[model samples]
Target: MMHVLYWSGRAGSLAPLCLLIECGVPHETVQVDTSRHAHKTADYLRDVHPLGTVPALRLPDGQVILESGAMVLHLAELAPSLAPAAGSADRAMFLNWVAYGAGSLYPAYQRVYHTDHIVPDEAARPAAREAAVVALDRCWDVVEAALEAGRPGLFGDRPGAADVYLAMLALWHPAPERLAAACPKVRAMKDAVWALPSMRQALAVHGLETA
Candidate 1:
């Protein structure tokens, strides 16, 4: 059995947890409450994840996999319908957008959430957050355009791991209402992913069911 380390609220673990539910794969969810700094504990760092992050996957063989994006891709392998086949024409596109979400958008949000850490000067922290928000809007524009071109989801017409990944990121936007207004297509895509029963269950677990 696989074990997913997670926490309540909108964390990166939401996507993989949703996929695990969608795939109907047996797994256990272990909450690492960040509010209490459980993730930074010595035991977690030594046994679960050296980086001390949630969304770490403990495979059946006891090896742990970190990084939510990597978990999404790996979980998709267990349920092929969630992603394009390994060498299919859509495979490249799928990988491209997933990387974009993980590499680009994820970091952009981190900049906003951790502006004080990124900007040493107290006076510059707000500016850093504003810049991050701008970058996030630009990222959404790219996704919105792609969705407008009739690609309902990153993996084709149906909501898949990539779609779930993007949706989770979308919720992290500083201004979700403004984001939805500016990127209607992205909103639609998020709605599509949210419509999935498994996704709803996962989101509810994360206390984001109304989001």
Candidate 2:
């Protein structure tokens, strides 16, 4: 069994939680609410994550894994049907898109959601938001181009950890309608993933509606 620290409404935490649900792994969740400053507490920071972030997973062996990307990847490995097997031809491409979601798109979203943290100055917040919007849109453009280059989903027909992660990120976009209109393939991918019974169940667990 795994224990995860997360806040249900947050995008950063959703990816791993969905993965665990899809994998049918038994796990417990510890809610860390930013509104209550639970994540910033000294004990939580010291004992769970030094960076005070959510979506940190404590494995059965007591090793804590930080970052949703790493958590989902690790969970996928535990249930190979959730992802491609190691050394498979699709593995490299799978890893690449997953890394892109974590490394590129997620940070842009953080900037959009927490502009104050990026620039503490009150007057500069708007500028930060504008920059975040631009950055996020650019990230989506890259993703749209990638999907257009080949088949649906990051690794073709199968929905891997990367596809799940990307779909969750898309849910966080400020204008979901605009996102769907601009990124048809990403929208298709999201719908396809959500069509899975496991994904629908996962969304139910999170109090979200199916796509």
Candidate 3:
């Protein structure tokens, strides 16, 4: 059984949780309360991860893994149902979807969200906000086009790790009201993504899903 040690929030590890669900593999999700500095505690780190990050997965043999992207890639390889066939069209699509999230979408979201976390000082927030908006707009456009392309799923006809990653990333973005209105494609893409059960669960965990 795979054991995923994670925080309740979606944060960076949200994709892994969704992938675990998609895999339908026997596993357990341990909610690590970050507010209490649980993730930063030495005991938690020593037991599961050297770095103070949640989503440190423990394999049955006792190897621990970190970083959501690498973790999901590994999980995909383990659970073929959630990945794609080697050298097939599905595989190419799957890999592209995965790359877009971690390479493009995720970095863009971080560029925006990091402004809040990294620039806590009130004085520096304005310039940071400008750069964030520019980055966010560009990211949204990229996703917007992909969804408009009419792919049945991120990897064609089925959801995979990449689709999960994109959905989780969208939750962090929140599809800003005006932005969504201006870009129907973005909202459509988000709607299509959140329509899945696994994505919904991740959103609920992240406090992004509404009634």
Which candidate tops TM-score?
Answer: 1
**Cα-based lDDT for every prediction:** 0.85, 0.80, 0.70
Clashing residue pairs for model 3: none
- CA RMSD of each candidate after superposition: 1.4, 2.2, 3.0
* Candidates by TM-score, descending order: 1, 2, 3
Q: What tens digits encode model 2's per-residue C-alpha lDDT throughout 75-112?
A: 88877876766798778777887889889998899899
Q: Which residue ranges in model 2 land beyond 4 Å of their true spot?
A: 1-5, 148-152
lDDT of 1 by residue, 116-150 (tens): 88888999888878988898899899998877545
TM-score per candidate: 0.95, 0.88, 0.80
Query: In model 3, what lDDT does residue 211 have?
Result: 20
Candidate 3 structure quality by residue, lDDT tens digits, 124-189 = 887987788777777767766766445534554555666666656665664467567665655655
- For candidate 2, the TM-score is 0.88
In model 1, residue pairs whose N, Cα or C atoms come closer than 3 Å (at least 3 residues apart or on different chains), thus clashing, are none
Error of 3 at 105 (Å): 3.0
Q: Which stretch of 10 consecutive residues in model 2 shows the poorest summed lDDT?
A: 2-11
Indicate the TM-score of model 3: 0.80
Error of 1 at 65 (Å): 1.0
